[model samples]
Structures are given as structure tokens and as C-alpha cells.
Target: MTIDESALGFGSGARAVWASDPEKSRGRLHAEETSRTRSEFQRDRDRIIHTTAFRRLKHKTQVFVAHEGDHFRTRLTHTIEVAQIARALARALRIDEDLAEGVALVHDFGHTPFGHTGEDALDELLKDHGGFDHNAQSLRVVTQLERRYAAFDGLNLTWESLEGLVKHNGPLTDESGNGLDGPVPQPILDYCARQDLHIATFASLEAQVAAIADDIAYNTHDIDDGLRSGLLQLEMLEEVPFLCELLREVKDRYPELEQSRMIHEIMRRQITLMVEDVIAVAQAKLAHLKPRNADDIRSAGQAFARFSPDLQDADRSIKSFLYANLYRHPDVMRVREQAAGIVRDLFDAYVRDPSLMGGHWRTGVSGFDEAQICRRVADYLAGMTDNYAVKQHRTLFDRTPDLR
Candidate 1:
């Protein structure tokens, strides 16, 4: 159904009219019947949960490598955290919660085994080609890589799910199809050609919430993980004014509390403060924009679920601190270097002999040109778990780092 974008007061009720409505979704590429018990977005969430890619997240890296510690956040755990925050934001805005949750759950499907380090190596290696992009890879996974159903190659998700997945981070291009920030990835462009996800437009409010939720999850958890890894000290958190404030408040409230409990109190409060901030901002924006429907949100050319200027400053400060103290620490960089080498070595090996790849990956090589072959190899490699990549590298090469 075509929505009247010129209309107003759609959000007059307790919730937002700008929220994505699964019942009024744009529908899937491969049409299917409405579920008896679940909304379209709910079905999308279920499909994501059962994907092999989702299962692989358990062994994928977040900040630390998977083998570093048992308690550190893996991709799986991070996705769960993001989903929870997304749901909370969605519910507060009176949007469809399931779409937000589904977007959150599948957002990281494209990440490589060793995290951004692995992605960097692949992108460098594939530079002559279209280059490796986790976001594009995520779109590829949901639209093509998955092969569970008898009729379709991918999950054939509702159009709304696919749209949110691609545009969760905001508009990729302008109305002219020119890149808004940088060149749009080839896979995304190609997919949009077949079924336009309106790459130039901002995504639904539910997706906007999921995007910010990602930031909230990583910022807080990375600090938590950094402390546990000894790369970050509680004292070092003082560098970020937001964390410093939270720490000061907690300390003042419970001067004699144990270290662990004090940290927990800080983390929980951080989540609460951030979540509440976004909800308040979103409510006001919805009040101002008065979106007639979800499509009006896409046309608004910005996100509804935005943090205030102060929170945005805090967000950057936290990221900068993480980069300097945790992600870029000498010990972490050493591990990252080793991880990059593994990805590069495996890419070279596979490009030379496709047989090195397993199953359907090997068989598909003959139909594509050299560039296509490299991407296929990258796809297979990108799908590997950290341990699997290490093992495969050892099997093919004379040496491999223990990555401890």
C-alpha cells in the first residue's frame, strides 16, 4: 500500500507512526504466505537465529579473539546485547520491536573470523577487485549465501528486513545514486539493482534504533572486556569524561564496594543512561517530524533515534579511548598482525588452487573470472571461525601463530 507522506499526526497516539509495520511490509523478493502465528519481522528473527552464520558467531571475535578468554564478548554475545538494547529502544518508541531485534541479531553476519583485523587483510588483498566489506557481505549472506530452503538460495526475508539490514547505518548514497560518504560497495549496488533498497534514503526508525544500539553495546562492553584483559584500567576510564562521571557517581554512592560490583554498577548505569537518552531524543523527534508513516521517516534524510550532542561527544570519547588503550595496544596489535597474516595467506592459497576451499566453495570457482574467484574465496574465508582459520592455515602453510 502506498503511504501518504504529506499527511501528519500519524504518531498522535502513545507510540510512533514512523515505526516500521511488519503487517504493511513491502513484501519479499520471493513471495510467501503470511505466517499463522508470527509477524513478518518475527519470522525474520527466527530465520536469522537458525542460520549457520548466526551459529558461527559464537566462535567469532569481537574485540578479543575467541580463545583469549571464556567470558569476553564473542560476536554472538555482542549481537545479543545489541538486540536487547534495540528492543528496549523500539518498545519505548512504540515501534515494532521484532524488526529492531532482527536487524540487531544479523547486523554482524559479515564480520571475519578475527574481527576487523581479518577484514582489513581481506580488503587489502581484494583491493584490485571490489574490496571486502562486512556490510556488503552481510547483505550477500542474507540474500544469497544461505541455502536452507528448497525454492530459494537465501532466506527470502521480508523486504523490510533486507532494507533495514542494508541501510541500518544510514543512507549509503544520494538520490542520484552517488555515494553520500564514500563509494557504495559493489555487492550492495548489484543487489539493489535487482530490488532497490532505496540506498539513498535513511532507513526505518526501528533500524535507526538498532544502529545506535550497536554503538551502545560495543562502547560499554569493550570497556568491560578491556578491564578484564588488563589493557584498560579503571583509572584509565577517567580519560573519557562520560565514563569518568559514571565511575565518580558509583564510587561516591558506594565508597567501600568491591571492585567487581562497582564496575557492574557503572556498566548497568551506562546502559540505562544511554538507552534513556536515545528514547527521549527519539520521542521528541517523532513529536516534531510527526511522520505520517514509516516511509516518511526514510524521506526525512536523518535518523530519529539519535543521541544528544553530549552523548555523541561521549560516544566519540569512548571510542577514541578504546582505540588508543585497548584496540591499538602493543599486545593487541601483535595478535591482530598474526590474524591478518592468516587471512592473507589463505586468500593467496585459495586463489592459486580453488580445491583448498571446502565443498560448494571449490566447485563454484570455474564459472567466474579471476576477480569473481577472489571474492568467492574471500566469502569462504570470511565465513570461517577463528580456530578454523588457524587450523586451515596450519594445514596449508609451514607455520601458524598460536594466537594466545
Candidate 2:
């Protein structure tokens, strides 16, 4: 039952010096016997896939509601894509592929049912209660909330996994403890009280790859989804020079290709080009940094895995266009408005009548104060799938806003 050593980032399949060696892992909060069959990172990845949280992703929104269309990417599909791209980047950069894949898979665990719309609503509702950050919540899920182990309430993931979950994009605070991106989330700081993740430094290279893979994934897929939903078109895509060039190439190469195939072709090529750009940028940076070990990567201060300057500019252009065209489109915004209302209404309903949350969630709510109750409610609401949220809203209110 032993995994091929090569597959676990060892032997001939082993990566460069800076990869996070599972043998060197900082280990889990709740100590358990190591698996004889799997690398710690691989164990983390498998554990994530088996979690109730991961399974819920099947019905969670990525860009479109699950009921909007069958083929549009759900959170689960997007996560798989992110993991694929992340592994590619890790393989190319000679880092731990399993760790990268695991981070990518778990990155969106904290997102609410209706994508950003649900998150925005929840954040507002909990603002006085220390607010909510998906990154912090992600760490919370793995370290404090999964409740699978008898000895631990959470999954009790390794420190490296938890660190990547919390600080994949960058450090949460500065060297002087000032928040780098406004106030750091309370959940993260509270966790740090027991396990100092050194929030002032960069996460490992595996984490950085997962972070950029997210950028690469959503940028390409959202456009594809936007087109599928009729919220975006080829004509509008021409406004993005990067996309325009890619589209022009596709047209010139296969003028007679059908719309679906043409879009898929464009997406694959876009992913290839963006992934290559990241590899090149990271290699050049790594050459200069010459990190001897994983620790050196953290203290290096600046990000190593990055898009080149040109690619970064193109990334911004794509994001801006999506913001204007797809995200802000009147129809989409209307749906988002309704989605936000659902989240807000549900939070209030749960707070007013904790019994409405029934099951184990209800029995646990008795001793909580206002903030604690709100947080528990937020967690319950956040974990709901789009269909469940809609059902709950229908059960609570005589009328629900039609997302369509």
C-alpha cells in the first residue's frame, strides 16, 4: 500500500531543494501516528477530499448558481481545475506537487453558497462580530471545525497546510504586527495564539502556486461561463488585447470551428500561456533568490511565484473587463442582489430562532452570547449549498426572491 516514493516528491521524482519535505513538516496540532502509506501532504489532500466541506462544493456556486446551467463550473469543478494547474506549476518549478494540489483543492472551502454575493452579505452581517475572511475561515475549517476526530474537533492538518490556507496570497501582517491588508481576521489571530504561523512572512512556494492557479483558473473559466450564460460574447472579448490576440489566433487558425470548440480551444491555450508565464517568472526569481530551503522562501519578503509584468497587466485587464461586463451586468447584479438578501435574511432568522438551525447546531447554541451566536449562525449559513439556502429561505419566509 506504499505510495511510489517518486510520486510523493522523493527519489527520482523528487523536486528541487525548496519543496516542503513532508519529513520536515511542522506536524499537526493534535499529534497522531503518521501514515505508513502516504506522505503527510498527500494525507492532507485525501483528508480534504473526504471532508463534508469538500463534498458540499458540488452544489456551491463558482460564478453561476448551480441551477443556472448544468455545464457551468461549480465550486467543485473549479477546485479540480485549480488543483490541475497547481500541480502543473509545481511539477514545472520542481516543488511538492501534492502540497500544491492539496492547497488548491482546499482554497475555496470558506466561500458561501452564492459566491461573492453571499460572502459580501455575511461579512456585513458579522462586521461588528470581527467580520469574516474566507482565508481565516478556511484555516478555521481544517483546524477547529471539521469535527471528525475524537481527540480533535477539526481535521488537525499539518502546520504547513494550515499556514498555506491562512496566508497563501501573502503575509497577513507586517513585522511590527500591523495588519498588512487592514485588520487581520480574529479567527486567524486566535489560532496563532496557540500555533504561531508567523503571519509576517510568505507561505511556502506550494502555497504561492495555489494562489496564482486561482487567478489563472477564474480568469479563464469565468469568461467561458459568461459566454455560456450569454452575459459575454466574442465581440466583447476583443476589447481585451490579450484575449483579442488569443481569439484572433484561434480565428485565424480555425475559422470554421464551432463556438463551443473555439471557446475550449481559447481556454486551453490561455491556461497554457498563463501557466508558462508563471513558471518563467518563478524560475527567474528563484534563480536570483537561490533559496536553499523552504524557510528561505518564507523570509524572502517579495513574492517569487508571479506573472511577468506584461502578463500581470493582462491579468488586470481581464479582471477589469469581467468586473464591468459579467459581474456588473444588470442581470447578474440582480441575481446577486437577491442572493445577498437570502444570506442576510437567513443570518437574522437563525439568530432570532436558533432552533431553526436544528440538528447539532441548535443544541450547541444555548450558552453563546450575541457575537458567538452570530458566528455560529454565520458558519451554518456559510456551509449551506445554494439549493439548501434557497430551501431554508422558502421555509422561513412565505416569499423568496426569484434569483432568475
- Tell me each candidate's TM-score: 0.96, 0.96
Model 2 lDDT, full chain set: 0.90
* Global lDDT of each candidate: 0.89, 0.90
| Model 1: CA > 4 A from native | 1-15
What is the per-residue lDDT of model 1 for residues 1-404, given as tens digits with 9 covering 90 to 100? 11123332235344456778777899999889899999899999999999999999999999899888999999999999999999887876778889999999999999999999989999999999989899999999999998899989888988888889999999998878789878899999899888989988989988999999999999999999989888888999898889999999999999999988887899999999898888778777776788899999999877888888899999999999999999999999999999999999999999999998998999956878999899989999999999899999999999999886
lDDT of 1 at 276: 80
* lDDT tens per residue, model 2, 146-262: 878788888888899889888899998999999988999999999999999999999999999999999999999999999988999988889999999999999999999999999
**Clashes within 3 Å, all models in order:** 0, 0
Q: Give the clashing residue pairs of candidate 1, or none.
A: none
